[model samples]
Target chain A: GAGVSQSPSNKVTEKGKDVELRCDPISGHTALYWYRQRLGQGLEFLIYFQGNSAPDKSGLPSDRFSAERTGESVSTLTIQRTQQEDSAVYLCASSLVFGPPRETQYFGPGTRLLVL
Target chain B: AQSVAQPEDQVNVAEGNPLTVKCTYSVSGNPYLFWYVQYPNRGLQFLLKYITGDNLVKGSYGFEAEFNKSQTSFHLKKPSALVSDSALYFCAVRGFTDKLIFGTGTRLQVFP
Candidate 1:
């Protein structure tokens, strides 16, 4: 069985450029999550998709950040006009389900975005 | 609003010695605690989690965590440390479901 996978393992782009990071969740994983890990800091939640619905988008840092998932499948996070401050490792994770008792979230290798 | 704190920025231990990474959390209700380890150039790997029933929960690679409700702590422990275990460890708490609240992470360095 495959785990979560992300594309563009490393990306270096100029400030004000836009980048789209892709994430392929594990098969049958209904819950997908996106998190940003800045240098020497904890992971900051970005967005989450349960099936095709985004129940929580409050974690998006600003209007420039948006993510979409197509029903328990691939998800794309688009950072419109990226800034230097957006330099970080974007990680994707998926779980069988989330809430209640407890479920483990499997993480991906992550896409390291560097804004020049 | 829930929060988690890994008090120590780093923990150093000799191989074959016991190791402990401290994590404390604040949540409105019952807390679901979890441990994750991230090796260099790798994503986070699930270590273990504590939801209910057990105070001491054992996880992969002989790692275990003790959930102390009174102390509001869930510390990851290993009886014997290994150099290969040197990595970044994180503790997370899920209270509300928007997302899991993760700690700042603690770098564990196991020396041989």
Candidate 2:
């Protein structure tokens, strides 16, 4: 892929319902990241995956928010029992590599999730 | 913990005028600073970053940012503003991990 791509540009779910957001990183990029942005706010780090290493979940808002990445390929962010506060744009980004200081992160168009 | 601060909630500039967006950061060790731009209904786009070397870093859209270590600031600057440059700008600082602490976004409104 030329750039990071996310599926279902917009999602609407009822309160307490679950929703799944998908991300396909750029080809061969080993680093993937997820972020949440409220209406007009800055990004909030959700989670990140780097190669085969254990994901750094420190930023996940809560246990309800979990994500998985398969061998540096596609990744999915699942929100269990979604709340109204979960309504925000879910963004995905990928970098060619990590550990070289600030690796430029290419972002996806983002999936707008709205919990009604 | 690493954190970033964008003092201005909004910056208004006229076309053809130089524009500036202020940013400051706090971190334990060396900080990796970055600026990202977001257009209407779009995800953030990386504008530039400050890692090492020169204090000035140039990025896309003919914009550049100066890293002032003494001030712990990395302010975005453009000599000439364009109407198309109106957007939301964010300053972020990378921690020891991949986590990037972001500041409240600053909206840039360039008037033609």
Give the whole-model CA lDDT for all candidates, comma-separated: 0.93, 0.92
Structural similarity to truth (TM-score) of each candidate: 0.98, 0.97
Residue pairs with clashing backbones, model 2: none
lDDT (10s digit) by residue, model 2, range A30-66: 8999999998688899999999999989889989999
Comparing to the true complex, what docking class would candidate 2 get? medium
Stretches of candidate 2 off by over 4 Å are none
Predicted candidate 1 versus true structure: per-residue lDDT over B15-102, tens digit per residue:
9999999999999889999999999988999999998998999999999999999999999999999999999999999886847789
Report fnat for all candidates as fractions from 0 to 1: 0.74, 0.74
Candidate 1, residue A51: the lDDT equals 68
